[model samples]
Target: MGDDLVDLSEMFARFSEHWSPKLVARLNDYEVKLVKVEGDFVWHTHDDTDELFLVVAGQLTIQLRDRDVVLGPGQLFVVPRGVEHCPRADAEVKALLIEPTGVVNTGDAGGERTAIVVPI
Candidate 1:
């Protein structure tokens, strides 16, 4: 990690791909990631680690097995470990994801949407 301050806006502006997470910082065993999301993501679960979603812009809807958790800018939600969920957005949504260093974005349902996170 760099000693310099990270500008989220600048990091976001450097990328344009949806579903791909860009690493911004590291917190002990966790990674702070930024991702652009639109449309629907795959239904998946992380059995060992919980996933955190913090909306930076636009709106996000986390479609759970039983209910949908909707989040807008400045809001955040933590999807507990082993809970199935799919993230959806009506428009473009910029979000900050906090999870373990090697946690896969697609969890157990990996496919095309799986992101290889690289620092911005």
Candidate 2:
């Protein structure tokens, strides 16, 4: 279904205690998610699709195989398919993620940080 704005703040506020993800929107087969992230994520890679991370607030550092990408408010980055990456936010970071539906945050590597996608 197509939705505008989708009331991000209110949806985001609903899960203040959850560290996982909330579905924000869907464009064709792609899905957008809003998440409050802290600490470091595990090393993972999506073998089939590209993953986009857009900073909504705070800061984020994405560790890649060769270099690191540091993102701030209004900034975004795309980690291409099959590239190893890990996302880290020293402080609290809010972000919007866009990727094909069913692409897990942990990708092929699954563990405790695999976010449960809570539809908004």
lDDT of 2: 0.86
Model 1 TM-score, all chains together: 0.97
Tens-place lDDT digits, model 1, residues 1-120: 387888899999999999999999999999999999999999999999999999999999999999999999999999999999999999999999999999999999999888899988
Alpha-carbon TM-score of each model against the true structure: 0.97, 0.91
RMSD, one per candidate, in order: 0.8, 1.7
* Backbone clashes under 3 angstroms, per model: 0, 0
TM-score of 2: 0.91
Q: What lDDT does model 1 reach? A: 0.95
Q: How well is each residue in 1-120 modelled by candidate 2, as lDDT tens digits?
A: 255668766766777643587887888899888898898889999999999998988999999989999999999999999999999899998888999988888999999877878687
lDDT against the true structure, each candidate? 0.95, 0.86
Top model number, TM-score: 1
